[model samples]
Target: MAEASYPEDLLYHPEHDWTKIADGVATFGITWYAQDALGEVVFFDPPEVGSSVTAGQSYAEVESVKAVSDVFAPLSGEIVEVNTALGDTPEAINDDPYGAGWMVKVSLSEESEQESLLDRAAYVASLT
Candidate 1:
């Protein structure tokens, strides 16, 4: 399982999604907290590329041994890439949530939506 960590360079949404932005694209994944809560992941049905996703919306779903949960979009964007590897190795979400588990990368559609996201400190604080 992934050790609990909230990377400093990333932003967080209250729904337990994390964001890593580079150029105009942003990568998204569930936080360590979200995966831990879900237990061992067994399936991940990712959205198709070229789809538009809005911030605070559910774009996909992850099924763990314990439950199925929606994967929320942390920013508004048009999807550019998806980690297809997760289809065969969904456990990567629990094993390396921030790395191998990244779900989607999107070309951001609304830059201003980022301001609503929390930083590492604020996100961790929200957990309390």
Candidate 2:
């Protein structure tokens, strides 16, 4: 896989969640690849603030014209904030998968878990 494939700075989950840590909190969202696969997102159901989420488990869901996809937690943690903007305009996800389309912030319970996820190179390779 080329360096230009997936965002190298983030961690990727097999289910398509990507997490970027900043100021000790991990911000998460679906990858561009995921949004493309889901197709024309129409709705997003984010977990409530302060909800506890386990690693490798669904914390939210996205409904698209094609199907519904679970948004998994990249790691075990408590959700601190959600991108409320997505609820009003879910298509933002397909238009900007890595920016304003971000889903939530999780106060990471175990920082070491970040090391276990796939990197950009590995994630792209996994696609094949």
Candidate 3:
């Protein structure tokens, strides 16, 4: 695996999830560091669109050739959409964890929750 990159535009959970907020909705995905650790992702099991997800909780699962890992929610919200494309090409997670690998979009229950997440610098420091 190569050195992982954390984008400054996103907030991060210590568990290696990233959240991109926009217009009360948040896009969620596992970080590059996470996918590298998980190995080649073989499956993505996502929650339903109408389902709720709580901050600091697992909302879905990604199975890799090495193991199955829980994908955590970085904010509390109702799921608005899931990345169905992952069902066919799970390796997109390993290839593009921040872009094509994005798992879900959510309508946030508490916008202020964003304050609790780590910035890119902090997350990179945590990795060290």
- What C-alpha lDDT do the candidate models reach, one value each? 0.95, 0.87, 0.94
Report the lDDT tens digits of candidate 2 across residue range 1-128.
Answer: 11223677988998888999988799999997888788889999989999999989999999998789898888988999999999998888888888888999999889888888998888888888
Least accurate stretch of 10 residues (summed lDDT) in model 2?
A: 1-10
Can you write out model 1's per-residue Cα lDDT over 33-96, one digit (the tens) per residue? 9999999999999999999999999999999877889999999999999999999999999999
2 or 3, greater by lDDT: 3
Q: Which order, best to worst by TM-score?
A: 1, 3, 2
Candidate 1, RMSD to the unseen true structure: 0.8
Q: Residue-pair clashes per candidate, as listed? A: 0, 0, 0
- Candidate 2 residue 35 C-alpha distance from true site, Å: 0.6
**Model number with the top TM-score:** 1
Give the poorly placed runs of model 3, Cα more than 4 Å off: 1-3
- lDDT-based ranking: 1, 3, 2
Pairs that collide, model 1: none
Between prediction 1 and prediction 3, which has the larger TM-score?
A: 1
TM-score of each: 0.98, 0.93, 0.97
In model 1, which range of ten residues has the least summed lDDT? Answer: 1-10
Q: In candidate 3, how many Å is residue 126 off? A: 0.5
